[model samples]
Target: MRERQPCVYILASGRHGTLYIGVTSDLLARLVQHREGLLKGFTSRYGVIRLAWFEMADTMAAAITREKQLKKWNRDWKCRLIERCNPEWDDLAISLGLPPLRTIEGTR
Candidate 1:
């Protein structure tokens, strides 16, 4: 199997809406879970499934540390970070080497 990518991601309902910071090796799979509401709790309840921002890391520890740090960040700082890499806040599924939502919309 291919090696996993360590990444930190920020999901949000929309601009200036609820935000969720996370780290995962399987970003694509995790995103799918979020989209499907399979991972309940904070994200599902707040509808924070939009892929707003992310950063690639070389190791899981780095990604986790970044995630923890980001979680402690104030909202304004987090928004600034997201805007830096994803000004438009587009869905980042493709960047993570995942198929587009169009490909999944009709299937189970």
Candidate 2:
């Protein structure tokens, strides 16, 4: 939502579902790419496009370090971390001006 800045974010397929951690300078653009399936790999393959959680950092190096630390966290820990700020596991990007995710009948 703010000007391009270092950020660490977590994406999930659904609540307590598959998770992906990443770092980016332009979070909004990166989120758009993920939602559009433009960035091929884990996110697109696993349908982990929900912005479950995120935190901005003062510097790129700090964001990268935080991302690395979060990547090493166990699944439960990661979920807890997300829940702390986002108990509903809502798509935070939508609140940041991105459109809400369109749901498929049986998909999460």
Model 2: lowest-lDDT 10 consecutive positions: 99-108
Clashes of each: 0, 0
> Can you list the residue pairs that collide in candidate 1?
none
Candidate 2 overall lDDT versus native: 0.94
lDDT scores in order: 0.83, 0.94
Off by over 4 Å in 2: 106-108
- TM-score of model 1 relative to the true fold? 0.83
**Which ten-residue region of model 1 has the weakest summed lDDT?**
99-108
Model 1 lDDT tens row, 1-108: 135799889997776678999999988788989988999899999878888898889899999999999999999999998898888776776676666544334321
Taking the tens digit of each residue's C-alpha lDDT, what string does model 2 give over 1-108? 567999999999998899999999999999999999999999999999999999999999999999999999999999999999999999999888999899888654
Model 1 error, position 93 (Å):
2.1
What are the RMSDs of all candidates, in order? Answer: 4.5, 1.1
